[model samples]
Structures are given as structure tokens and as C-alpha cells.
Target: MISEPFANKKTWVHSLDPRLRVCTAFFLSCLFAITNQPVLAACALIASALLLGCSRPPLSALLRRLAGVNLFILFLWCSVPFFTPGTPIAKFGPLTCTQEGLDLVWLVTLKANAITLLLIACIGTMSASLLGHALQALRLPDKFVYLLLFTYRSLFVLADEWQRLQTALRLRGFVAGTNLHTYRTVGYLFGLTLTRSLDRAQRIHQAMLLRGFTGRFPAFVLLRFQRHDFLFAILTALFLIFLLFFWNNPFFP
Candidate 1:
């Protein structure tokens, strides 16, 4: 459900041409990755928020997704500072955090948030199939594009299979715990799931063959670019370029 929310939303971001959106997201991602300055990183994060606002996805869902991402980021924040070497800022027993480590943590957090926000706004506002086609349009390798397409399609199928397995287990009076029986049952479940997945893959391949699915995916819809799409892409690029230029200006030096 969360995966395909883009199809239901009719915002300005969703209205932009997917090709331009993909390009803009790619450029922004590169920009975010290369920048090391904390101020520039924060700016990137702000830009992501602004983009998300324009897309207008459900706020609660957005927060939930962001919270899940932050869990991993929290781990990085906790562990990264302990290993990085620099001027010690705080001591906890034998372990201490360096100023450089603190800076690294902040940079990682900012970059993560910025990229996540940009993706939700830029690429997440469009259907996966269309996005795949847009990638193809951009001359990305067909194998990579199709890999993305198949992966997206199969995730839901795998999730459904997992849910069914859980339901069956529940109906069979399965009670999960840290006991030996629970562990053995889980092992069986994993093995069975893998077997079923292999079977499903074979069946899917046969079905595709019957339907004349060549290695290339047929275009379902033509992508059209409007004046607004170009305008949006241009404006976004200009703003990012300005920020990149400003970050290197002598004021900060």
C-alpha cells in the first residue's frame, strides 16, 4: 500500500514528468553525497522537507517511514562516534566521543534525511512501472531497469506468501517463543517458504513465456513532458546549483 501511494496522489510533484523528476533526484542525490559541510548538509535536509511538503503525502505515514529510517541512523550515531578519532568531547567510562565523530554523526544523519526526503518527493510520487520506463528513457541499462521492476513486483508477492504462512501457523495452534520447538518450526517455515518461492518463480516464468514477455518490457503508457515539467526541473536545478556555489563561497572561509 505504501509502495504505490504515488498513483493515488494528484499533487504538483506527481504531475511533473517522471523523466525530469528522475534526473533531478539523481543530481540532487549526487550533490547531497558529495557535500561535506554541515551547513550545506542541513540545507540539503531542508530542501528534502520542502520537496516532501510539495508532494503532500500523508504526514503520519511520512513520519512513520522516517521513524523507521531513524532507528538505523540512531545505531550509527551511537556506534560511529566511539570509533572515530579526534578531540575528545565527552567521556563515558572508558569510551569517549571525539569532536570529529560528532561531526560525522551529524553529517550522516543530515545526508540520510535529505536523500530520503528527496526520494519520497521526487521518485516516490510516481508509479514504479512508470519510473522504470523513465529510467529506460534515460538510457539506463535495460537489465538494471528490469531488475528494479521485477524486484518491486515480487516483494508484494513474497509478503503475501509470508502472511499466508503466518496465518496457517496461527491456525495450527503455533505459539512462538524462544524455545527449541519454536526455533525448529521457524526453520521449517523458512525452508518451506524458500521452496514455495522457487516454485512460484518457475510458474511466473512459464506464465510470462505464455504471454510472450520478451526480455524487454512493453510500454504501457507514453510519457509526455509539459512546460511546467521543464520549468519545475529547471528551477530545482538552479536552486541546488545556487546552494552548491554558495557553500564554497569565501564567507564561510
Candidate 2:
């Protein structure tokens, strides 16, 4: 089964309406993506961190997620500074690192971390089903919502099928190696998995039809926008306004 470690937490952040959270995350991600000022990006990162702290997710899981995000940022750090054109700040052999590249990478690092943290604080606090319902409530296209919900459900089935295939391979005395035989065996395994997955999907569709599943899924729990939700929205709006005001006016160069 897929893990939802943060969803079970009973924090104020988790209690907010899922629709509000979804909207906030979407806007924050978009804003941060286009922000170029390092100071503004740093402030956004701090705000995101504070929101994440309010959620109080498990420390280990949070660290693991952040580590995964930074791993990609680390790759950028290794290459971006060398190829960008600007005044040279450092050099090793024939390679040169420039101020412009360093600044650009720093901005990107701050924005990426800020958006990721914001998403975890907002969207990650809810279950997948709740997210789908929230999207529906926000007037997203029915087909898109259906696709999201179905894909989320299918992931668990796929994981189980992959595990079963791996077990069968082990039972047949298959040992992995750096050889053409191993490569061919792995390819066959994937092909068989795909075939089984298609069959399972057909069975699932038939079952859904038998159960009278219409085009839309009825949400069991209705979400309400409470006073606290309004308060949260106001605070987020103010923060966004502040960021916009200082977007190009960095406090410190």
C-alpha cells in the first residue's frame, strides 16, 4: 500500500478545508516559480518552513522528502555554475564558475525548496481521495479528476503485481547479473507485468460497471469553508502581497 504518513496527523493545518489548501498550494507554487529575487525567495522559503512546522509531520519522513528534492538541486549545483556566462568567481583547470550562474542557481534552489515545502504543508496533509474531491469541488474537469483518482488507485495494484512478479522470478532461481541474459529476463518480466496489468484493469472496469459506478464519484464527506479557513486565506494573501511588493526590491544585494 502507498504510505500517507502525514495525512493522519490532527493538526490545524490538516483541519483546513482541502479546497483551500489546494488553492493556496497552487498559487504559492506558481508565484515562487517565477520569483527571481534571492531575498524574496528566501522569505518565501521561510514562510513555507513555518507552514510545514505548523503541520508537524513526522521528522524522518520530512527529512527523506527534502533529501530527495535537494538531490536534484545538488546536480544543478555541480553543472549550472560552470556553463553560465558572467564574471568568473572561481576556476579549476579549464572550467570557470561565474557570479551570474551562482546567483541563478541560488534563486532556483530557494524557489524549488519553498514550493516543495509549501506543497507538503498544504497538499500532503490530505489523503489522495480528499485531494480528488477537493479538485472536483474546485470545478476541475470531470475526466481529469477521474484520471487522477484512478491513477492513484491503480498505483497500489501495480505495486502488488510487481512484487508478485519478483517473487515468481526468485522462486524460479533467477539471479540478477550484469549480462545480456539478465537484461532479457528483466525485459520479459516487465512485458508480463504489463499484460497482467491490462487484464486486471479490464476486470476492474467490469466490476465498476456491475456496481453501477457512474461517470462521477460521489464524495462521502462534504468539505466546508469555516471561519478559520477564511483567516488562513487572509494571512496567505497578505504574505503574497508582501512578496509582490518586495519582489524586485531586495533588502540586501
lDDT of each: 0.86, 0.93
Off by over 4 Å in 1: none
lDDT of 1 by residue, 25-48 (tens): 899999898878878888889988
Question: Per model, how many backbone clashes are there?
Answer: 0, 0
Clash pairs (backbone) in predicted model 1: none
- The TM-score measured for candidate 1 stands at 0.89
Q: Mind giving the per-residue lDDT tens digits that candidate 2 earns over 154-230?
A: 88888888899999999999999999999999999888888888899999999999999888899997899999999
Q: Which 10-residue window in model 2 sums to the lowest lDDT?
A: 244-253
Best by lDDT: 2
Task: Quote the positional error of residue 108 for candidate 2 in Å.
Answer: 0.8
